[model samples]
Target chain A: MSTEIDKSKVVLYSYWRSSCSWRVRIALAYKKIKYEYHAIHLLKDGGQQKTDEYAHINPMKAIPALIIDGHIIGQSLAIMEYLEEYRPENPLLPKDLYARAIVRQMMQIIGSDIQPLQNLKVLQTVAEFTGQEEKKAEWAKRWIANGFNGLEKLLEKHSGQFCYGDQVSFADLCLPAQVYNANRFNVDMSHYPLIQKINKHLATIPEFIEALPSNQPDAEVQC
Target chain B: MSTEIDKSKVVLYSYWRSSCSWRVRIALAYKKIKYEYHAIHLLKDGGQQKTDEYAHINPMKAIPALIIDGHIIGQSLAIMEYLEEYRPENPLLPKDLYARAIVRQMMQIIGSDIQPLQNLKVLQTVAEFTGQEEKKAEWAKRWIANGFNGLEKLLEKHSGQFCYGDQVSFADLCLPAQVYNANRFNVDMSHYPLIQKINKHLATIPEFIEALPSNQPDAEVQC
Candidate 1:
């Protein structure tokens, strides 16, 4: 089950503020896997991700594509799993099978159920459909609040210091970016205290801090 | 790494037409794992999944929750991974690590990207936001088409007889349900020949046929 890694040539195509890309960055930092960063501007030049070359690298035309083990891996969750399997050191998953499943369940509550509804392209589509730009944030806020309601309840049973009993699992990797997006959308965090507590605790961790969207190379350069 | 399964008590909370639930059903059938089916009717009596008892079982209040190995595992991908790990006999993932990542990449294209955008709750929100019931189908079709465009390209490089090589991996588990959904939304399948081909091939497999929406116990039951 072990795969050899040629770490020198590892590359990550990422955007500064993409919640999905931020998840991968957290995993890479937590696992201490060094990679070349290629910024794909989601807002500049009519969305650089839509370029044919980027599309060739990642058919999904999505951020957080990883070039590792001589293959192009797309999808943040997929990339994180590859990183976990590729470098099992500093493991991002639990050793117990059920705990691992729980961690994944928590991860998907954010990744699949929440983030996709609020990501840039989907938000853009929402704007187009509604013909009201302000509706985008309103749309994002409602879905994030909906997902966080369930997540906060789940966390009440699962949280110790992290999303899954004190371990900085993949679910933790998802939490900060989502909270960041939530704040941007003006989601009322008063209702989800557990999520806020976990997000605040994760802030003090070096790996999580280092992967912050504000710290990425492409964070504030004018588009 | 193996967790003992109490095959007798295995329970699945599912809705017949849910694409996510169908995924777990397919994996269970493929691996010959028997489970008790508890129908969570998504449209009857104000959605059985929203009941307090079901919410307690799955905090996310989502369908396709598996009660196995003394744990209530939520999320279809997580349940499938548990199935793969709990009983590794007819593995749903490829042996090679990189190939496994590719398989997962393919799965998330459908799971995270496509399915979520068009799932019942999201579509319901779409209808509410636009104040037009007809917008639901249009929204679903657009997102499905957007994802299928990328998926068809990925399949071109990866497909042999299924979504990833000749094997019936988890990606293959995801295809039929999505194509079923796409067809439900009246998406033009001519643009995604690879998806159509894989969907066609999956139909011949007994495991897939047995898990089809029409075969589920609750499929045609009246409200």
Candidate 2:
């Protein structure tokens, strides 16, 4: 089933700390896909993502656009889906249709419902609107809590050792990055016992652990 | 390949003006899948979506949750994907994996990147942040324009009469609703020629026309 596309050209444009970027990294790791990594410092140089050179790669000015199978796929979900289709082994989706939909629903609880509102750009906008720097964290925490509240409820029906059943699905890829972001915003995880339980277990998985922001080449060494 | 679930149980919880709801509407119409439409007025009674009953249907508390095949699928993209997998006839996704990925990338440009940031709750939050009722449209327009700018670029490479080639993929389902929302916000579409062209073509589609917000059972019938 190999195509004419060269495998060596696969590259991932990513930022060390971006949640969306982390999701793709975990997907790549979990699938054991190989790729070259190019760090796009989202906060450095007025966002390297906003530059003309980067715009040629992704007009959305977003990170984690993967160049694979001779195509540039933007959006983490799109990229992950492409990978799932490109290499079907160690599938990120479940075998059953209902389970797959539930996994996607859990993923969107973070992807659509939560992450967009609390991203770096939106937080910066909130700060500008209120003229108060502290409002940034407050704003991020509110949306995180709001989405986690729904996510925990869904987890009650769907979660086992992971966000779905015992298998680590696409939803689990989203969990660690979001929980990391929530901790930064001082979101109390005690309210989301199911999420806390699953995230705790995910921390021990090599696929999740290897994709941690701290493990990335561009990660800033903390003081 | 028929399922045991009753087709009569297929239901869609939707709001007339909701962009995400409209996306699923178009998908269902395109596929000719029959379902019961239950309107959840997002603005009435402090949002019918906030009720505990609605939470059971979708803990994310969003509209366009489809109850089909004896399963409740939340998130427009998730539901749409479920639909694509559930009924392979008149598929919303392309057969080619690269084409499927491209369609998804175009869809996410609206789904993940644009729509979430400009939805009802986020707009209300924006108004509360600035204490100016006018900032709501301004905020919505900004994100819509930002996303459309990228989308138009992608369309240049992918579009023919529709968003990707002449065939209507899932990306086309997202177009009319977003264009309708953009028009409401007064986003100058002159900058996005490709989007404007594709949107114009999509209007002639029966599936799209039938799913227009104004065509729904609960439409407010604006003066």
Candidate 3:
């Protein structure tokens, strides 16, 4: 089932501020895969994703696309899971079926629940269509709180130092990227100590640090 | 890993019009898993999910909850995958890894991309907080089309009789449930012949037919 892929041959179409992109960046770093980054400015010129060049690559007009051996994979969770399956050395999911289900469930809380509500297009459309900038923040805050609360409760039962036991699974990669966006939008997090503690621990990991928005070349211009 | 349980023991907390519930229903019927239908009207009493009992069953206050062995699992995709894993006699995923990934990506297009944009909560919040029903529909239409277009392209490469090479996989369960909702909102399907062909094929399948909103006990009162 394995194909020999040159480590340097892989390329990621990413945006530094895109939380979806951050998920893949962390997964690649954790898997210790060497790849080149092709930064796509999601906000530029009504989104570079809509351009003829990028449309040929991804019709969905979304960031965080992975190009491996001339095959393009979209969807952050799918891409991350693909990497885990191909590069099983440093596993992102546990070997046990129940444990894998738990980890995948936690990832779903972020992927399906939190991130979609607060995606850049959704928020931008919220403002454009309604002219309610404050309510946009309110929308993001409400859903983030809703998702994080459920996650906090789930983690309380299983937390050692991360979202699922002690391992830095895909859940760990997803949570910090989402929480970081939530913080930037002024979503309060003082109540969940476990979430705060896990984020603190995640901050210390070099893979996470390297994938931070601040570490990307495009971060300065956007900020 | 197989556990025997009484046919009458299965319980589903579902809403008649919910696309999520429809997905689970199809999965359960496809696997021949008999279950009791427990209708929790999403709109009644400002949503029955907010009630103490329902909330206890699903902390997320979402629909399509599967109660098996007295344990609850929410989120339609998660519940469907769990059923597929537990009841492998009728597999919903392909035996090969690449085929499985393709099925998963198709499911992701619905679960993560299309359905999230048009979710009840998202539309309700947009209407209540932003007073932009028209714009919300536009947003929904855009994402749905985006997802379907990518799916259509993928199907070009992958389809034989379904979204992933003939056999009924999780994608079959997902696409019809989503496209049904999209069409209810007048999302034109004229362009996506592949999707249309598949959905037409799926509608005749007894499992999907049984799960239709019109067939549910609570459909008349709710819709």
Error of 2 at B19 (Å): 0.7
Q: How well is candidate 1 docked (DockQ)?
A: 0.75
Full candidate order by TM-score, most accurate first: 2, 1, 3
lDDT of 3 by residue, A192-212 (tens): 788899999999999999889
Task: Please provide, for model 1 over A1-223, each residue's C-alpha lDDT reduced to its tens digit, 9 standing for 90 to 100.
Answer: 0134344588888998889999999999988888888899998999899888788888998888988767889999998998999899999999999889988998999989999999988998888888889989999999899899988988998889999997789999999989988998899999999999989999999998888888888889532
Q: Sorted by DockQ, highest first, which candidate order results?
A: 2, 1, 3
Question: Model 1: what TM-score for its first chain?
Answer: 0.94
Cα lDDT tens digits, model 1, B1-223, are: 0134444498888888999999999999988988898899899889888877788788788888998877888989999998998899998999999999999999999999999999999999888888889999999999999999999999999999988899899999998889988898999999998899889988999999889888889888531
Worst-scoring 10-residue span by lDDT in model 3 chain A: A1-10
Which candidate leads in DockQ? 2
Say which docking band candidate 1 falls in. medium
lDDT of 2 by residue, A74-162 (tens): 99998888889888899999999999999998888788889989998888888877788988888899899999999999999988888
Estimate the lDDT of model 1: 0.89
Error of 1 at B34 (Å): 1.0
lDDT tens per residue, model 2, B85-128:
98888988888999999899999889888898998898888888
